[model samples]
Target: MDQVEKTLNQNRLVLFPADQLQPGERKLVKVDQIEIAVMNVDENIYAIRNECPHQGISMIYGSISGTMVTSKPQEYQYGMENELIKCPLHGWEFDLKTGRSVFSPNQVSLHIYDVRKEDENIVLYLRRSPEKVIVQDFSCNHK
Candidate 1:
């Protein structure tokens, strides 16, 4: 049986082709040994970790909407459309652009990653370099 494999260490990961995502759409991807969410908000690229800080649930799968803005008691306004994602179970709204709590803005936040559409691909920059692996079979050459 062939048990050898080749691996490339990388500092970046391409989630998918840029054209696959349209404005206001998002995709979940697992690459570079991590799960992340890539989103296209008005043609802008945004990426974040999929886990919710509060409950360890899939945060990217939550509903996308704008957070509520207010002026006074009983007087409220909805703004920043498509910039917030509400948790499916807890209803905790998080800012997609800033990865912070929409209202609290300090109590909690998500891990945001550096992402961009480059060379027709959506690339995520990893914080650490991945280890490269290659097997050197000396017996094959000597025997």
Candidate 2:
């Protein structure tokens, strides 16, 4: 487990495991004290930081639907669901793919990780400030 930086590098990280994350399932992974959300989008996998940049809320427990997360508080009275992770306090919508918030543009975007499949094993790569953090050795036999 190494430290992931802000720039993506191909050789820095290793493949953890190859497991298809089905829809509606949440995968919690840790990379150097950072909790990441490994979500399953269709047949592919995507990773992003679990914390929301708006107010530091865990995105793993936020509103998740398909590939979109709601950061803002849903207006149930106005009928707002399947929108985005609405922060539950302020109301924001972050696109799952780009980790961009619809509410705030200048705000920092969610840290996105690079993921790829290697012979049925899922490998993730993250860019750190200095170097790349590679997390191999994920126990796929546990569950």
Candidate 3:
């Protein structure tokens, strides 16, 4: 593995005190040269990349709301309440639970990290993919 990848895989960075962020609030953190947006939704912690895929804007300034859909005229369905984050610049909605864009769930997505409570601190796990390493090796050999 590359040195950076190895270091990331072995590290579990403590972001902040778990109680620092109140429910329905978000905070921005930097780790390994990447900006991460950490949120507390209904007491559950979620972390995602801070940049919006559309315009590279900071998603930490975005607004949070529920997922809304319409099945028919004048019939609107509301679900996944308080679990959606809308980009402040372009209004792109992302599901905090799955990190998928509401408009293009299949194609567009946000990079999400696993967050957990380690004692009184919030810990973030930087995940690395073995498949990515294998792909890099295959490309290097072909080149």
> Which portions of model 2 show Cα errors greater than 4 Å?
1-8, 11-16, 65-89, 128-143
Question: What is the lDDT, from 0 to 100, of the residue 73 in candidate 2?
Answer: 75
For model 3, which pairs clash? none
**Model 1 agreement with the true structure over 86-143: per-residue lDDT tens digits:** 7777988888778998757888998788788878877767656534322111111100
- Write model 2 residue lDDT over 1-143, tens digit each, in one string: 23232333443344354553554445677655777766654455767787878788867666643333445676323222343443445556676667777666568577778776656666566545423233422222111
In order of appearance, the predictions have TM-scores of 0.74, 0.60, 0.76
The candidate scoring highest on lDDT is 3
Ranking by TM-score: 3, 1, 2
lDDT of 2 at 140: 24
Quote the lDDT for 41 in model 1: 71
lDDT of 3 by residue, 1-143 (tens): 11122353554656567777667666666664677887777788888898999989987777778777767888989887778888889899998878999999999998888787778887767664222211000011100
Superposed by TM-score, candidate 1 places the C-alpha of residue 30 at a distance from the truth, in angstroms, of 1.9
Best TM-score among the predictions, by candidate number: 3
lDDT (C-alpha) at residue 10 in model 2: 47
